[model samples]
Target: MTVPAFSLRNAVRASAPLAGALLLVGCVTGSDIEGLHRHVGDVEKRVDALAKQSSSKEEVAKLNENLGKQVATLLRSNADLGAKFDELTRELQTLAGKLEDANRRLAQLSQQLAETQARLAAAAPPDAAALPTSEATPGTAPPVAPAPAVASAPPRGGAPSPADLYAQATADYQRGQFELAREGFEDYVERYGRTDLSDDAQYWAGESLLAQKKPREAIAAFEKLFKTWPESDKAPAAHLKKGVAHLDLGEKAQAIVQLQFVVHEYPSSDEAKSARQRLKALGSDSR
Candidate 1:
């Protein structure tokens, strides 16, 4: 019985340490569960932050896309406006040019009318007594001497002088006897080339030829006037008529040269104005 009691005491001592180890293990398990809960909460918070960042990036992309579209639309609108402005500018330029041309034509007409009135005022009244004697039938004019002769002394009275011959030729020209007038004027120029009215007679001879559609003869007469009386008051008129005669002969380059000469040499004269008009018609831009 003493040996049995001693075995029981040893067993009790071992059981006491085993009970303490079990209690410590239970406390450690509870602390581990609390740490697991904290880790799960941190992971959830991180996922929420990532979701918000993704949504913000999507919103920013949409806003940027809308802004790009608006900028493209504005650029297209500006380009269209620029094209319309350019078209309007061209139309305005065309209209302005047409208006300028109309104004120039109006001015030319006024000048022509004024010149006609001045000429009528300067001309002398017609004499009925002189008209019947000077009026010759068409194609039935009296013959003038082929070569001019020295004027004979009047029959004890003052006969018509060289000046009277010029006046009679002018009358024939006014009556549209261009052939007879041309011959008479040529005779006057040949015989009285140094007289005061010689240049006038020569110029009228050219006019007579031009009226009869004789461009070559007209050109020759005008050239003679230019060479013989370069300082005459009719020089500019001769140049102008010579240019017209060249045009009649279908000599465009020669016409331009003669017209240009008139314009350059007599810029302030009526002949120059006519030359400018002719040049404009011929597509020359000479001022």
Candidate 2:
């Protein structure tokens, strides 16, 4: 019985030595464990650096995208502004052109007005006896009427009548001697203001004033003809001349009204033709 107990104890002791040998064989080397720890630390450092670099790159890319968007918006805004500036410049150029044209027309009108006033002050009145007389026929006899009982007197050459003087004045006017013609015409009108030639004299007198560049006096003469002889053949012409006088005075609205009346009332007359031409020049030929 004692031998059986020793055998169990010895079997347990032999198992303990076997277990210690296996432990020694399976244990890690010191150098290998240290190398593994160093490798793990390097990996941790590399991961941290990689994460920081990746975050920086993402931030830079986002900033670049935002900058690109801002630059694009600025370019678009600049283009829009440039387009508006171009439109405004064109509009200003058009307006300037219009103003220049208006100024030129105004200057022309002023020059015309000044010239028209200079001729009015130099006109003169006419002399009746200075008019030419027709020679007597060879067969015409001398006057034989009995003289009054006082002192005997011989008959003198008969002076030309107002009609003959007016004829001479018209001939002078046609020959371009407007100053002399204007005097004669005015004399005829004054001497024969109640005669049938009064209206004709008045009209020709105004025409002479116009030929002399006396638009104000011409206007007065024409207005007198129109008012005094509304039914005369010269009425339309008088109104036409009056319109021209208004134009000389820079009265465009009044000139247009009078010219329109001429065109409307005397459509078939030469005066109407002149009025239409004037209306076209004034840019008011809508009719």
Candidate 3:
């Protein structure tokens, strides 16, 4: 592997032209070098895309399927929510219907209680015999006396109990003694004005006046009751009777005003029902 000094010198001299020619041929411009780099980069990008093409398509397909499943789940949830909403609506409607029916039944029971308390104040068998039983006897004649009220009068120089006085007053009214009934009820209203039955006594006084065919006096009595005891449960009945008294006197305008008042102020009362009937008969039903 060692060469003589003269042979090495000769070999270097002979390769000088070849080295110069090689340098001259490799002298490229900057633009030509950049173009070669761009070509290499483009080739590398094309190869990478071709190698991943099938995998990229498969990944996109999987993504689309996952999205479809999510959409279907959302649709099912919406359907379930809609069904629940419909069920709640139906349940509320049923509850409202039941509440309305219960209200109607309660109104009827209260009306019956307000109209009938004769059995509570009956003093003896004779008084009891004068009233109808729980069920009506269809063939019985129309009542010759009061429909269902009577009590023996209290007898003493001292003042009687409130109950006995009230019972006796009602008894007088029922027994066709209108003047005596009016006097007794007026006395009760004057003395027992703060008692629970005071308003009722005043109302009966008006009824007594009406029974005697004194429509003007009955209206005055009703007006007194209204001013004195506006909160009485008997207010509606009083209004109805006042309206009827007006009707009996051929005062159609006055009757309409009173009847319409009942329909408006006591819509749930039995008197309201009667008022509505009367209004219909007078060709002025308020509906």
- Best model number under TM-score: 3
Model 3 pairs in collision: none
RMSD of 2: 22.1
Q: lDDT by residue for model 1 over 1-287, one digit each (tens)? A: 22333344455445555555655788546455555446545655655565567679889999999999999999999999999999999999999999999999999999997886565344432333432343331212222322346655643455345756776787788788989889878888887888877888888888899889998998898888888888988888888888877777766666778989989999998778777776766655444
| Tens digit per residue, CA lDDT, model 2, 120-176 | 323221222322234221111211222234643333465446656677787778788
For each candidate in turn, the TM-score is 0.45, 0.43, 0.46
Order of the predicted models by TM-score, top scorer first: 3, 1, 2
* Per-candidate alpha-carbon RMSD to the true structure: 20.5, 22.1, 18.2
lDDT of 3 by residue, 1-287 (tens): 63444454455455555555555688756566556556555655655565467468779999999999999999999999999999999999999999999999999998876554333223121222432354332211111222325554655767765676677787787788889988988988887789878888888888888889998999999999999999887788889888887777766666778989999998987778767766765656664
lDDT of each: 0.73, 0.70, 0.73
Off by over 4 Å in 3: 1-157
Predicted structure 3, TM vs. truth: 0.46
Clashing pairs in 2: none
